[model samples]
Target: MHFKLPNKYLKYGYLLALVPIFFLVRYYQSHDPEVNTGESFFPSCIFHSLTGYHCPGCGSQRAIHDLLNGRILAALKHNLLFIILTVVLGIKGYYYISKAFFKREVVDWTYNKYFSITVFVLIICYWILRNIATPPFCHLAP
Candidate 1:
């Protein structure tokens, strides 16, 4: 008997390939040491750099860096929301890959009205707390 991959399998394979690339980038960033301490190679967040204020995504890179370095507390300090969001996204990605490759089922994610409303409320709260709650709360900003 001969084996051949289905189109769906090929798509799953491509996605799985991204997993390694993701780790590679994480490893490089974690090991480099200089990426975080010095002026980052990427553009500075214009909002923070100029105004000393943070946007919602301000500390995401630092959070990821801390997580990659196995510093959970530090990561959370940088951006708890970013850490939570990354975990949620990672789980969703894993679910899709598993469905596509192993289960041979279509991936479907549905958020009920309550969940949607809760998420919306949480986002608004986070935004207001980060901007207005004072220094320590705003530390999560960036």
Candidate 2:
């Protein structure tokens, strides 16, 4: 039984869904998520709240908010890893969308063992660096 998804739906549907996301990011760019001011509605990091330490995603919300507002330096100050990952994932999305438009298989994203391992290691390193209290790594904390 070979049941395949219709190309017409997959292609246009993704583009339609992206419209709200585009507006959402733009809205965040202007409306201010207010992540750092202690007045933000966003939930606190459970890992941080319980362990009293920074987690890999501690400042990602603030980083995204800053990034959307074109504050590159401030975004990096909040969470460099999130910015990097955003760019990487954005490129991946571009690839998938292009393929979808051409009516190709969407699962064409190949998994590379080495690349996955490297990303995992980098994320772990960032998690550890953000927790360090020293001068060099201290800036990584949110």
Candidate 3:
């Protein structure tokens, strides 16, 4: 199937809308660096609270905060999944933006079922490993 550009308003407007939200997230992460603390405005992960186990997205907020502050190692320590997914999404976003602006056809691996399954399996494994208290697994925790 050919990649068709949507209406101009919807196409560029969506990106324009995201600009403020992006800045808002950056500003919040900059001002409130203690997302892991109870006193912070960010809500605790409900899945983790209910199950007493780290969810796939646990520590993402803190990871975002660390990433915004240029603490790449700390961000990875908080949530490796977040880092990995961010990189993947960034690459995907680049392709999408290029397609929208430059009208270029690129090899988008996201359409492959194997890529989807791999990401799903990775998330499940990361979720389980982060909850395991064993030596190597313990390091995966937030």
Candidate 4:
């Protein structure tokens, strides 16, 4: 049995594209700053700074760093949405890459109107829920 690159350009291009992601994860791993720190090592979220509230993306940078450092619970504590999005996107990327490079027939993901609306509502709810500093909802804040 033998395997070969799908195409010369694609093979090199795919590997080259990964370099930046690799470096980004590496950077995060090295600079794992806590989300609630006064002296933030990572770039601050402008929305959070002006509003004194956690934006939908407030803790995503710290979440990524925690995830890279093998702190799954801490990562989730920072931003559950980022973790969920990463998993969803990883699955999609895997399917597309396998289809393109291995000649595998990957099933297409269908976009349904109801599903789209549900996701949109869920995100809005999550945003609102995290901002609520009461009971279980308070735990959602980073």
Best by TM-score: 3
lDDT of each candidate versus the true structure: 0.71, 0.81, 0.85, 0.82
Query: For every model shown, what is its TM-score relative to the native structure?
Result: 0.68, 0.81, 0.86, 0.82
**lDDT (10s digit) by residue, model 3, range 1-142:** 8986667867878778999999778766666545345555777789989989999988888888888888899999989999999999999998988888788988888879999999999998898889999999999998
Cα lDDT of model 1 by residue, 87-113, tens digit: 768877778767866775654453458
Question: What lDDT score goes with residue 65 in model 3?
Answer: 84
Model 1 is weakest, by summed lDDT over 10 consecutive residues, at 31-40
Model 2: residues with Cα > 4 Å off, grouped in runs = 1-3, 35-41, 102-110
Cα error, residue 91 of model 3, in Å, equals 0.8
> What is the clash count of model 2?
0
Candidate 2 residue pairs that clash: none
- List, residue by residue over 14-57, the lDDT tens digit for candidate 4: 88999998987787888767644555457787978998888878
Preferred candidate (TM-score higher): 1 or 3: 3
Model 3 steric clash pairs = none
